[model samples]
Target: MSDQTTQRHPNILFILADNLGYGELGVYGGGPLRGAPTPHIDGLAAEGLRLTNMNMEPQCTPSRSSMLTGRHAIRSGTYAVPLGGVPEGLTQWEITLPKLLSDAGYATALYGKWHLGRDDGRLPNDQGFDEWYGIPRTTHETTWLTSPGYAPELVRPQHIMEGRKGEPSRELQVYDMQERRVIDAEITRRTVAFMEERARGHQPFYLFTSLTQPHFPTLPHPRFAGSTGKGDWADMLAEMDHNVGEMLAAIDRLGLRENTIVIFTSDNGAEFIKPWEGWAGPWRGAYFTALEGGLRVPFILRWPGQVPPGLTSDELVHGVDLFTTLATIAGVAIPQDRPIDGVNQCDLFQGTSAKSGRDGLLVWVDNRLQAVKWRNFKAHFYQQDTMMSPPEKLPVPFIIDLYTNPREEEGKRASGWVLEPMLKMVQAFEASLVEHPAIPMGTPDPYEPPRRCP
Candidate 1:
C-alpha cells in the first residue's frame, strides 16, 4: 500500500474556486491583466488539457449541483443559492459524485465549501461525502451577517462544519475573518494532508477541495497580501495559485503523481461586480447571468499516463458530465434508475476525441429557463442585471452566433436561425422529463420574505 504504484483506477482530486473568472490565470491571459502570474495553474494547462468550450450554469448552487449529480439543477431541487434562512438545497432523491465513487470502494472527502444543502438531511455527509470540513453556505453569508441592521438569526447561520471519518458533522464556530482570510490556505493544507494519508493506504480516494477565495470580500492570506500590487482580486488569485502548488507538491512528494488525476476549475464564471472582482475574459455578464461570461469557464485536467500532455480541446463538455465521466473512469456505471445529463467524457480526457458527447447545454436560473446553447449558437430567452435582480423573460429570444460573437456583445444575429435547433433541443429535453419530472424551483413562496431586505 505504501508503494503508491499499485492502483487500478486513478485517484481523482477535483479543486473548485469560488468566483474565479476565465481571465485570471496565466493560460487565460490573466497574467497581464492581474498582477502575479498563475504559473502553477497555467502549468497544469500546459501539462494536460485546457478546455475551451466547457459549459456550466451561471450561479454557484446550481453549478455545484450539476457537477455533483449528473443531472441538471432543475431536477435536483437545488436550482439556486438559497438565503435568509430558506430551507433549500439538494434533495434526497438525487445521488452525488462522492456517493457514487464511494459506493465503488473509493474514499471520498469534501474539504471546502459545500453549498448544496444546509440542514442535516441535505448536507455533504448525508449526500455522499465520507468527510466534510468547510463552510455550509455562500461566502456572502459572512458579509451579510456582519452588515448593519442584519437579523441575528439570518446572519450567523453558516460556520466551519467538520465531518470526519468517524465523528458526526458539527458546527465548529461562527465564520470570522480569522478563518475567512486563510480559508483557502486551510483547504490546501487539509487536501495535502488527506492525499499524504491516503498514499499509505490500499484504497484509492476522491477529494473535492472547494476553496472559497475570490468570492466577495476577497481577502488574501497574510503572506500574499499586497504581493500582487494589483488589488484584492490579484492578491487572492496569486494566493489561490500558491495553494494549488502545495497540494500538487504533496502529490509529487507522496509519489502519487502517476495514479492521481487532478482537476482545476471554478464554480461558475468570473466576478464582474467590483474593481477588485476580476475580469470575465471575452464574454459578457458575470457570476449570475445567462451569458457566456457567466457560463464559460476554464477546465484543466492532468493525468500523467492516461491524459496526454500539452493538449487543448474545443469540445462541448458541461459540468453535469463530471458524474458520468468519473463513473466511467472508475469502472462504475452511472445510475440508470434516474436520468443523468452527464456523459462519459473520458475520450476527451485521453485525447482520443476532439468532441464531447453533449451537443448543447441548457442555462437555467432558479426554475425558469434563461438560455439554450446548441452547437455553435446561443439562444437567450431571459436576462438579469444581477443575481439579486429578477430575470425578465423576453417576448422574443435573442440569438448569438458564438463562433463569431463569443463575447455575446452583438444583439440578435439572425434571430430566426435558432428556431429549428432550439425546437430540437427542447424536444430532447422534454423527453427526459417523462421519467424524472423536473422538480419545482426550491425558492421560498412569494409570501415568504426576501433573502436580504435592502
Candidate 2:
C-alpha cells in the first residue's frame, strides 16, 4: 500500500438509541436504574469525549433524516410520519452522510432500524448504504426477529428486509409486535458477523448500528430481564448496553479499536411514557414535543488518539453536525452548493474549542417548527395550547429559555429570559418558510396549506 493508503482512514461505528435521555447513563449521572449500570457505555464515555449540550429532533424519523442528510429535518421532505407518502419523501437530490463517505472509498452498512423511508428506492441501499439490514419504517407491526412465520396483529405498517451487493433481496416478517422482542441474539449475531467481515477488508468502513432497544413495549432477553433494579426498562437498557459492549469487544478482538471512531447517541429523548423505567434525568416530558427531555440526549464519541479521553464538553452540538464532522475527519470535500446545516466540530470534540460553529439550530417535530436553540437560549413553541396539539397554533410561534427552564420543570412560569433575538431568528426562519411551507395539517387535500411539517 502507498503511504497515503497505509495511513489508516478512521473507521466509524455510529450507534443510535431510540429514546434515550441525557441522564440515563452512568457517565451522565443517570444513577443505577434498579441496580443495573451502563458500564460499557459509561466506560466508553470515560475513555472518550462526552458532549453535554447535544441536541436532537423531538422524534425519531426527523432526527434520523437529519443525521443522514446533514440538513435540518424540514429540508428532507419528512416533516412527519407520512400516512400515504404524501409531499414526496426524502428526495434523492440530497447527498447522505453514508453516501458521501462511500463515494470517498468507505464501505457503508446500516444495521437495525432505518425509519427514514419505507420504499425500496428510498431505503438505505438507495441512499448510499452498501449493505442494509432491519426495519425500513417505524411501525409496531413488525418484529425484528421472527417475522413472516408468526403472524401477529401489527400496530402499524413496517418494512423488514435484508440486502447486499448483487444478491437477491429477502423479505421477512421477523419482527414480533406482540412479543416486543426482535430476537435479540440474531440481530447481535449479524452485527458481529459484519464486524468480522469488515475487519478482514482493507477499506475503511462506516457502520450505523441503529438498535431498536429501550423503545416502547420494551422486551429484554431472558438473561437481562430482571437484571436491572429499575424494572423491564432498565433491563432493556442493560441489554442494549451489553450489545454495545459486544460490538466494542469485536473492535478490540479485530484490533480495529485504535483506528476506529465510535460514536454513541440517541435519536431523540425518552418517550412521554417511560418504557423501561427509563428516566430523562432532570428533563421533563418525553418524546413527541419540544421539551429538553425530548431533544437533549447523551452523546459520546471515542477515537483513541484523535479525541481526548474522559473529557466533557457543554458546547452545543446537534445530530446534523455529524456529517460535516465526519467529512472533515476523513479529509473529504463537502459540496458547497446545497445548504448543510451541520458544521465540523472536530475541534470541539478534541477539547480545544469551546465555541459551537452554529449560532442557532431550529428544532422541528412532525414537520412543524417547534423550537429554536440560539447559543445558551432555547425557545420552545407549541401549536395548540395542549402539549401534543396540532400544528395550527405553531404558525404564531413563541419562545422559551431552555437553560433556565431546563425541562420545563417550572410549569407555566417563564424563566425571565428575553425573547427579542429568538423572535428575530424565528422571523427569518418563518420567511424562509415561504419557500418551504409547513406540511398541511388535517387530512389529504388537493389544496395543501402554505405551512408544512418539518
Candidate 3:
C-alpha cells in the first residue's frame, strides 16, 4: 500500500472513566443493580472486545502515566500524586502515544481530567497532545475542595479546563460539587464539537474524552439525579454513560464509526463514597488499596470490522499496552531503546489467541510497590517505612493465588505454589525497581506526596 493509503489510519477515541470498576457496567454482570442501565457501554462491549483481566496502577496518575508513556510510572518519574506543583512531569525522553500518532499525521486532543501534571512544562501541550482541556493537576480536590473546612484532605483536587482553542491562556473555574449537572453537560458539548471539527478536517484524529464523573463527590446532573434508582453514585455513572452515548452518536453521525477505534476504560477502581454498592461490583475494597477491586478495572475496545462484535477475552492486559497496540495499528514505529512495559495485543483482540501476552505485571500505590501478578499467582509487597526505607530492603514478600482468591487474605495460602516463575518475575521486576527506586513518600518530589494546595 502507498504511504497515503497506509496513512489513512483509523481514528482513535479513548474514553477514560475515573475510579470506575469492572462490575459497574451491565455487560460486566452488574445489570441487576438498581442503577439506571448502561446500555451504551454495554453496546460497545457487545460490538467489540471486553477484556476480563485488565489491570492498572492502584492510583489514577500512575495508571494514566503508564498509558501515555508505554512504560512503568516509576520510569516516567510520575510515581504518585504531586505535592504542590508538578516539577518533573512525564520525562521528555518518553515517547507518548499522542506524540507518535501526531507524528503520523493524526491530530490529537484531550478533553476532561488530566491528572498527569499541572505545570506549564508538564501540560498536555508539552506532553504531545496538540490540544488539551481539563484539570492540570490530578483531580478537582486540589483546586475546589482543598479548603480547610471542606472534605478531609484525603483525595487530590479534580478540576476542569479547555485548551488550544481559547485566548492562549490558562485559568481555573470553580463550581459547586453538588451541581455537576451544568459542568458535565458543558464538557460533553465541547467534546462533541471537537470531534465534529476533527471529522471535517483533512487528517485522521485521536481524541481522549476523560470523564470526572463517578470519581468522588459522586454528584450527577439534575436531569439524571434519581434516574438510576440506586443512589448518588449510580446517578453519576448513568450520566457518564449518557455522555458516552452522545460521543458514539456523534461518531456515527459524522460517518466515522467504520474507520474509528473506540476504547473505554477506567484509570483505577472505585473510591469511598455513599451508595457503597455504586463502585466495583462483587469485588472487595475500594481505591488506595492493593485489592483486585482496586486494580482490575473495566476495559472495552471497539473497532467495527477489525474487532469481532459480541466478543469477550480473558487475556491479561494493562492500560499501558494501548500505546503500542495503537502504534502498531497506525503503522508507527515504537522506539526500541526505551523501556516500555506494554505489548501489542492486536492478536488477542482478534480472538486468535488466548495467551495474555504478558508473563508478569507490576502495580504501585502511594509510591510503594504493592503487588506483582505472574499468571495465576500474585505477590503482594508492602513497605514498612515509605518515607525512609529503600524498596529492596523493605521486607519479605507475601504470595497469593489470584485465580482462587482475588483478595489477599491473612490465613489463605496457595500450597506448593509454583515458586520458580514467581521468583524469577519478582527478581526481574525488583532489578528494574532498583534501577528506578520508588520515590520516597512525603518529599518535595512531585511523585512522592499527594498534591496539597495552600
Candidate 4:
C-alpha cells in the first residue's frame, strides 16, 4: 500500500474461505447460532457492502477459477475438481486478475490454497503473481498428511510450496491436518509481512489470501479450539474471524487502510459432508448441487472513503465479476482480447447505483449447466439432491421462485413466468460460446519434477 497522495492504484486484499456457509457469517445469519460469533467478518459488512444475492458455482475449483479469470470454469478447464489437480488449469494464455494487476505495476502474491493446477505452467506464480506460498490443491486430498489422532496421515505428503519469479517453486513443508489447525494464522502472518514490505516500497500490492478452513478436517488452532460450543467447524470459523481481524489491523497499522480494498468471500456454499457438514442456514442442499444454498455466498467489500459504509444490496452479482470489477477499481483495463464474463460493477460497489446491472448468472455442476437464474425465478435443468449423485433430468427445466421454495422442496414446471427469461439467459450463454468458441475439455498435463501426484 502507498500514501493516498501519491498512490495510483489501490491495494487489493481478497480473503476467501473453503466451504463457508452463507448463514455462517453474522451478517448472513450464522454467528452465535452456528456457535461462532464473527465480529471481525461482520465488521466488513458494517463498514462496507454485503451482497445478499452474490453467487458462486456449487464447487470449489470452478468457483475459484471463475472468480480469478472472470470466465466460466468450463472455459478454463477447471469445471470440476480434478483427481489431485490434473489436466492443468486456466491454460497459460488466460489472463487473471493478479496478472492484470502485476502488469499494471502492482505487486501480486497469493498465500494459501491454490487448486488451479500445480504443474510448471499453472501454479499461482505461473499465472500472474510475483510470489506464491500455499497448498497447490484441495485440503481433503491432504488428509493423509495429518496425524492419526487429528486427521488421517497420508503415505504421501501435500507440499506447501514457496514460489517466486525466476526461481523454482520450493517445497517449504508438507502440511498435515495438525498444520491445518494453525495454517490460517501462518498465512495471516505471511500476509502481514507482505503488507509491511509493500508499505515501505513504491509499488502497491495485491494479496489473494485464501484460507483453508471450515472445510473438512477443520482443526482449529489451540486458542480458538472449542471457543465455539457447537463443534470443531464452529471453532474453526471463530479462529478465521480472529485472523481476519489481525489482517485488517495490520493494514491500518501500516496506514494503508483507506488505500486498500478488502474483500471477504467464499469459493462456494457449505460442504455436504456429514459429521463435518456445515449449516446452510434456512436453505436446502450444500456443495455439489443445484440449490441456492450451494451457489449463494457472502460477498463483503470494504474500501474506506471509496465504498460507502453499512450498505447491503441484494442485487445480482456473480463470482466471475471479480476480474472486471477489480480491474476497474485499480484503473486497469479488462482484457479486450478475450470475452471476460465479469461485468464492471464499480458503480454498484461505490453505492452510486442500487442495481448491480447484471442480467443473470448460470448455475453449473461440473461441466453441466444445471440451471439458469434470472431475477427471482430459476430454471433447473437437473434435479440433484446430494453431491456426487446422479442428477435427474426434467422434460423442461423446473422453474421456481427462490423465495417460495428457499429450501428447494419442489418447483413448478416452467411457464411464461420462468421459461421466457430462462430461455433468454440460456440463448445468451449459447451465443457467447458460439462467438468466442471455448476449449471445453483437455487432459491433464504430466506431473512435474520435485513431487509426484496420483
lDDT of each: 0.81, 0.73, 0.73, 0.82
Q: Write the per-residue lDDT of candidate 2 for residues 1-454, one digit (tens) a residue.
A: 2325524568899998877766778778764743468889999999899888888887787888788878777765665655553533466666788888888888889888887666555677877888888877653444433555443364344546788744544676645564346444556777788878877765678899888876766677777877765677777778888888998999899888888899999988875553343567877766777777777899999999888888888888988899899888887888785567788898888777878777777777776677777877766566432235554554434555666666554354444354677678778766756765543322222333355467
Q: How many collisions between residues are there in candidate 1?
A: 1
* TM values, all candidates: 0.93, 0.86, 0.86, 0.93
TM-score of 2: 0.86
lDDT of 4 by residue, 1-454 (tens): 3355226698889999999988888888888888878999998889998888888988888888898998988776689887653365667777898888888888999999998887667799888899988898878755664346544343457777889965678887777766777778888999999999988885688899999988887678988877777778778888999999999999999998878899999899987776788877777788888798898888999999988999988888999998889888788888776678889898999999988868688888988889888887788889898896799897866777776766666644335566776788778878877666665545444322122244
- Candidate achieving higher TM-score, 1 or 3: 1
Give me the runs in candidate 3 sitting further than 4 Å from their true place.
Answer: 1-7, 32-34, 85-88, 138-159, 165-169, 175-179, 273-278, 383-396, 430-454
TM-score of 3: 0.86
In model 4, pairs of residues that clash are 87-444, 144-153, 144-154, 145-154, 146-177
Candidate 4: list runs displaced more than 4 Å. Answer: 1-6, 84-86, 145-155, 411-414, 443-454
**Stronger candidate by TM-score (1 vs 2):** 1
Error of 1 at 164 (Å): 3.1
Find the 10 residues in a row with the least total lDDT in model 2.
440-449
Local accuracy of candidate 3 as per-residue lDDT tens digits, 1-454: 2335524698898998888877888888775473667899999999999988888886778888889878878766777766653264565556799889888888888877787666565677766778887766544463366466666356434445555622342765644454344566766787788778876664688888888776666677888888867777678778888899998999899888888899999888766555433456766666666667877888999998889998887667887898888898988899885557889988898777868678777777765667777777767776322223344532656677776776566567675465567667667867765554544322233333233355
